[model samples]
Target: MSWVLGNLDVIGGHAGAHLLQALPAIVLAFVLALPVAKLAGRLGVLRGGISTAAALMYAIPSLPLFIVLPIVLGTSIRSMVNVIVALTLYGLALMVPAAIDAFRSVDGDVLRAATAQGYGPVARFWAVELPLAGPVLLAGLRVVVVSTVSLVTVGGVLGVPSLGMLFVDGFQRGITAEILAGIVLTAAIALALDGLLVLAGRALMPWASAGKAPAEPSPAGAPDPAAAAAGGAA
Candidate 1:
């Protein structure tokens, strides 16, 4: 408790830096993923190849990727750019499939109706398809945000600024408080980001929450005044 209180400034600063690294990567991944997803969905020949490449990139261990990225990109070993690039790759891996699935989940009949109503391809995609696909795409975004926040700690190993620095420092010096603070802070950040995304999704997709209206009362379920009148007459 005393350690955490003492290091509040350090923890907060690093947490801010952690978000700085993660949010941009997640945003970039979502933006870049749309086009990749569109191409993959439209081109059958490319779907498998694109998915496989994303999977392979994701499969590579984070630490090794961080170590190698500076060499490949010619950035400094401790460059935050390497961390951002690595995290962006991970976000892409997760988001591309989600985007493809979201787009595919739109009903064929609805699309046909949209086309028949004079909605051109681009117009349909923006006004109809994207709105309908919002729920699934937002779900993917939540996942990517949480995953990226957790992975940002790995950048600490490379001496990039983040909450992971606490972990590295704690482990080396055998300080339990620093380690616990890092773990708790990381979880808190992930949860906060996820909650914000959920709120954003709900705000943007009011229709999703507006479920079907109640059915009208059926004749069998309601008292039938005409039947009662006929029975009384009889």
Candidate 2:
């Protein structure tokens, strides 16, 4: 506790740097995932290939990717950009499959109804398809937010400024308090961001908060008593 109090400024700075690296990756991954998922939905032949590739991409160890990306992009191995890009790829790999499932989960009947109402492709997607997919997408987004925040700590191993630095430094000095502080702080940041995403989702999707209305019985296929009586009179 004394150590935390003494280095409050340092801790705060690291946390800020942590957020700066993480948040952008989360947003970029989501944006990229949507279009790729949409493409995969349209190109049935390509869906399997895309899923396989995303899985392979994610299976690549982060530390090695971090080392290799610098060569590909010509950035310093320790640069913040390198970390952010690596994190984005990891987030993207997770988000793509989840997003594909989200879009696929939308009912085809609803889309047909939207088309019957004279909705163009763009209008139907923006109004019906995207809104229907929102809940699942929100679930995936929450996962990405938590994962990204936690992953930022890995950058500290490479001498990038983040809470993970405490872990490295504490291990060398054998200060259990510092290590615990790092773990606790990293978890708190992840939870805080996740909570914010939940709030944002609720605000954007008020209908999801209101419990689903009871399913009304369908009138189709049931004989109409009035029609039967009219036929008998005729």
Q: Model 1 lDDT vs. the true structure?
A: 0.91
**What is the alpha-carbon lDDT of model 2 when measured against the actual structure?**
0.89
Residue-level lDDT tens digits of model 2 in 26-141? 99999999999999999998998897788688888888888889999999987999989999999988899889989999999999999999999999999999999999999988
Q: What is the lDDT of residue 147 in candidate 1?
A: 93
For every candidate in turn, the CA RMSD to the true structure comes to: 4.8, 4.8
- The digit string of per-residue lDDT tens for model 1 on 1-234 reads 898899899999999999999999999999999899988989988887887887677898999999999999999988889999999999999999899888888898999999999999999999999888889999889999999999999999879999999999999998899999999999999999899988988899988999895675467887566677888999
The candidate maximizing lDDT is 1
Off by over 4 Å in 2: 214-234
TM-score of 1: 0.90
